[model samples]
Target: MNFRQKNVLLILLACFPFGLIAQAQKKKSKVVTDPVFSAFSYKGNDAIYTDNPLKADEFYNPILQGCYPDPSITKKGNDYYLVNSSFSMFPGVPIFHSNDLVNWKQIGHVLDRRSQLKVDSAGISAGIYAPDIKYNPGNETFYMITTQIASGIGNMVVKTKDPLKGWSDPKKLNFDGIDPSIFFDDNGKAYITHNDAPDRGKTLYNGHRVIKIWEYDLQNDQVIPGTDKIIVDGGVDITQKPIWIEGPHLYKKNGKYYLMCAEGGTGGWHSEVIFVSDSPTGPFKPAPSNPILTQRHFPKDRKDKVDWAGHADLVEGPDGKYYGVFLGIRPNNQDRVNAGRETFMLPVDWSGEFPVFENGLIPMRPKLKVPKGTERKWEQGGYFQNGNFTFNEDFSKDTLDFRWIGVRGPREEFIAKTKDGLIIKPSERNIKSNKVTSTLFHRQQHNAFEAAFTLKYAPRSATDMAGLVCYQSERFNYVFGITRKGTEDFLVLAKTNKGETTVVASVKIDTGKPVRLQVVANHDEYRFNYSTDGTNFQNLGGTVSGDVLSTNVAGGFTGSLIGLYATTGNDIQPQ
Candidate 1:
């Protein structure tokens, strides 16, 4: 009896362990099958299509649309390269290439690596500001100088032989200024110009700034000490008490050295003023017709309005015609701007010794002549003809297109491209957080447009949610997502203004099927809707205020963006 009992006990012990292993395997499989997932595919409406065909003799203003402001253009051989300021969004300093200057295409970003930039804790519109791109034909290299304001790096310069591939590591310059620019002279010497606080003393007035110059030693990769000199104090006219004499660019044309700068700040008083000097540094005289380019003189009651036109850089076109690229904003009647400052182009007419921007104060002419022999494909030339169009993203491709941008630096772990669709994991940081969040978005290219995406998401806890957002900054944004309250799930629309979040609308929903969330932007108002099925959508509740997302209310230098985001709100992992 004892031998039989011992053998039976051994069998039971081995079988009991096997039974437990089998149960654990079954639990793991359940977790894998019921994993938290969400899918989104979007397409815009193209009903209000404009039939303005691209003409060989004429082109449109805003050669590059959207939030591409503070442009710095440089020419290499027959090819021209341009870059714009990218504030807080990572992959900063988006570079574009163009042959005709009218039709342009994005080459890549200068600061593509997280090591090359530091914007993790940067506030909105605080990362990179007013980058100036230049090509040194003597050295056969390209240099880009910019200010990383939020990173507290002052002005940094990055150079490369091939800008399309990538740029070199940033060399933090020992300069105390913003909007730093580099000018290469005919003598192989390099000069850097920027705007800094006058004399570095105590505060005088709000906008008391000066344009200073320094001799930069390229071989040493630093500015020579004691070479720092104030070139223009208090802008073109010290009596006017001009402010923000920044974005300084130096050029030598027809035996005259011209120093151009953006004056009167970046608001309604913005303007471009120029001065001529015999040498790169020194007794520069302001042009009689000062403020060569500005929209300040244009009446507010004009039929068409474009304000804040300044921060200009001049480039000679392929046909030897000079053109200026500058930043301008179009504000609604409420003085709220949602599109942010965009890059605009105007013809430059030489007046004796200085350049005068044509069409001064009047609305920019929509039609202009392209350079002769300038040829472009149909798809590349008509970027601005139709103000709006449908953008369908299926996420079937292996990599995201260049139009997509991530906040701060992109966290690769938060995004996964699956065969079915894109899979995004919720980060601890949400859109409203000042810290960098895991969100990928595109610019709100149009003021009046619709954005919708279908997502299959199931939040396990009240802290987990995934959906769409129209983000302006950490302090101001709108979110529409499928959120959980206890065990129940609801589709919610919320707005965050000045760090205060308020739920605008919410509707209880079944978690059994996918949800389609849509946002329709009509001027300064936005309407949010959701649907179980793709065709029929039910409006959540009231209209969300879009003005709060504007630059006037949000107080940033960047435009709003539409994106898909997920946030866990805490460090807890999804079930």
Candidate 2:
């Protein structure tokens, strides 16, 4: 203890004030200089979940995995609410909760903050699309309706009498188009149905959409004014020119007023028809079993293949059976698609007058049966699987675990967990910026997974860069980190197709020690590795070509977003 008595006891413990808040959290934990990661590790090996396993009576066809597509469901008594499609990411819409509908549980994000999702500058496929959770019970309330195309907020609504406690912020809903949905009838009346076009200019083909409805006014929740009504037109059969007749969903069961919808145009000719109606405005009708769900007549090399199925919704299960919730696609070995667009679930016989999907039109078996007593022992955590699982994330908690998201902005702006880990903070825009920076994503759920992280960066220049990203938008992706090329410190890898990038590989590391950065996919290849004693690891690029993380070659309806990137505008380099 000499050294002038340790500098007079560190200047007498920096003159109190809790030592100046412990010297500003030790200078905000060195804003990440080296040894940076905060631990991450995903697993899911998917070979049809190791060639078909789970069987305590089965269950697992993408109970929410990867891009979590356009699914929407509702139920109140035995409580089961679900929703998906978070287009420009950034907490757009992801809401789940179940009571044995097969165990789901992610109770948050109904357009979480930022004035209810503005989608920064949009374009990661352009902000939220197709989200529609409902449950009116004549006012027991809970409506989500969505379409937020960014900034101008197109088609909206958000309520909650309770969704595990959270919601209500956006209300916009004057409507324009793109999957709306809201129907609550039984003398309490209330409607809103969506997906438009067909009247204006009376157009006919080229995906001529239609399906209108309107007369909502649930005590001024909008939509009244003109009574709207157009019900089903371009769908079920616009003379077979039916193109993108978007996701609709309207129901009333027994007394009839069905509606459903979602025809072709979501890729590979998607579908899910149905339409009938005695009221709720619609001469509806059109169900000679019309696409009661479709994998477009199968044969895309079938074998654990589940293609662009549909955009369904339909609930009733607490053993009363019914259930639907759609949006499929799991392609690889080059049929394309990269873990984007998931969330399945079947069972929907409805005795006879319409409502099929019980193993809907064949070729979709990823396994499912367990309905006996609702989830009869879904193996402990009550099941929430993606087959071969293992997630492991620990940014020193206290929050940030809605499965870690962020894209067009707001992840508390640029993250900051601490006690030494999740601090990210790079953002000066990068990841090909369409606005929001400081990446973070997570949703590439599996098509063969591996993921890994355990950082401690040290970029400092080459316009700084931080690692891992397999994203499929903001112009296709795949980066692999560590920057600075001048005074050394490399580790690149690049590869962005539609936005033009190409650095194949690089090395020269030692970014101040702790590093890990993996990736691994394998359904059509994609490698990229690194390590610095976290047990040897090496492989900088090698495999490649998960077809720019497919969505039929990244055209987008999303799927495959594996971020955790950082920036300062790094332009990427290596080659």
Candidate 3:
């Protein structure tokens, strides 16, 4: 060996010792110099549940509330499984289980592992789209199909024998589309359908899209090459000019293939349409009762309004009857979509050949009569869905609740579980960054709700801060927390609208014990409150407009998220 090569090898050997110092550096980053939050709590107080109490035979409209949208369901004997689109939330599709279809319990997410959900660098609305979960009785296995718009993983599917345990890693399908679903025919054949652009090059109108179907190979877990066909082009009637005809699910009823899809875009003009075909892939005909479900035709100023209804999935209930689960929204009094699209359930009337969503064509009522033989246990409070309810998280358990979620990364990267509560090790990334931050979020479930967190922290640097965040997106949100300026600590409330952040209120604070930060929203108004003592709370920001947090102003696909946040990139200054 040359003399210079020997010297270079010796230098490399001297630094090759990955010992105690290197292990410590690998455990925690040197730049992450933020505080750890001791404990956190959240509550919901909507007046709708109190004013209109549930009768002995009545329940709520939305089976699952908050930002849970794009619902798809499948039945396995008596047990039923449901899933929803999570967008960029760390754990992708949120799954639920129900026996009678009335009282549903969350079973956790399908893509829980980071390797399966590669959205670490994706935006809040760019990660996971509509997820469809179906149980193939032919193979006795469950499949979850979705579109990961990030990481070049276009459409994918995962499988599990039992959902309560966990799910498998995703298998990438050779297709380019957004929302994909699987159908298993009675004759032991499978097909995959999704929303895609019009066939290559064609004269397209505004929002012109098509639904394509592909023969799926069960053993290979992939779409057969050259077996693709466009099933529905343009929508109900091509002459009428339909838009965004996506989220398609195929079902066979009475020896006929029924293809149902969401027509129009996902916003105000959304509607559910049905089609009939003798074969799985063929010239499908739109039902005369075409818009089986919609709320766009109703007056905008209706009472207890639930608008933006579409993107539906149907499953037969336990009682020999049909039911459909779809996504809809309840705009606030100011006609703002702050809570995002929620999961609503309605019985489907299939007395005729084709199934129709009952009460889906008319104005959506707040409550529905409980069907016969279905248990009425969901009427009780404390569960977060159906009517108004209260939910709290102590973070005492080792495993976090399914409701609390991170945006682009795993919660374990910046969290430590203790007997006291959850410990959030602050990250350099703030709430406004596209990167993953030290924040655990819960969806703002109601228009009128209260969210608070008790945190004991000390900021050693001016950039260190830890408290509560009411998040709509990275560009539109409000941060209420304790930050440091020079040598003094202050409680500050800040708002970020369309990427510009400004401090709305600030006050000096000095507390050795734990301090509580709270935010209350009454329709369009929001208030930030703080408490040094456990009992008494003082309002710092009087009443701020919630216009920025609304979809009408924010122009995003997600709802507002209330989070326990800690960050070193604290921008809001103390005044």
Query: Number of the top candidate by TM-score?
Result: 3
Over 1-575, each residue of candidate 1 has an lDDT whose tens digit, in order, gives 69999999999998999999999998864441111333443333222224344566666566665688999999997888989999888778888887778677787789888878899898878999999999998899999999998766779999999887689999999989789999999889999999888885744678888888999999977999999999988887777677888999999987678999999989889999899988998678998888889888767766446788999999998888788999987665466787788888888887478899988556655456677677544355433322454666777777766777888877465788776567777776778787877777877765667877778777767777788888998888888887778778878778788888777777788868877788887668789888897799889757767887798888889998888888877222212
- Supply candidate 2's per-residue lDDT for 235: 76
Worst 10 residues of 1 by lDDT: 32-41
TM-score of each: 0.92, 0.37, 0.93
True-vs-predicted CA distance for residue 530, candidate 3, Å: 0.4
Mind giving the per-residue lDDT tens digits that candidate 2 earns over 1-575? 89999999888877776888989999975564533567788897877787788767777887887888888988788878888888888887888787777777787788778888888888888888888888887778898988888788789888989987888798898868878888888899788888888777888667787878888888879988788978777777677688878788888878888888888877778889888878768798888868888888878787778887888888878777787988888887778888878888898998988889887787788878867686534456534555788878878768877877888777887777778688777877788779888888888888888888878888767878888888888788888888887788888888888899888878888866778888887797878887788877889768888898787777877878777888878888755
- Cα misplacement distance, residue 497 of candidate 1 (Å): 1.2
lDDT of 3 by residue, 186-269 (tens): 999999999999977874897899999999999999999999999999999999888999999999988899999999898999
Tell me, what's the RMSD of every candidate? 3.4, 20.1, 6.8
Superposed on all Cα atoms, model 1 deviates from the true structure by an RMSD in Å of 3.4
| Winner of 1 and 2 under lDDT | 2
Clash list (residue pairs), candidate 2:
35-456, 36-455, 36-456, 37-455, 37-456, 340-559
- Selected candidate, larger lDDT, 1 vs 3: 3
Q: In terms of TM-score, which candidate is stronger, 2 or 3?
A: 3
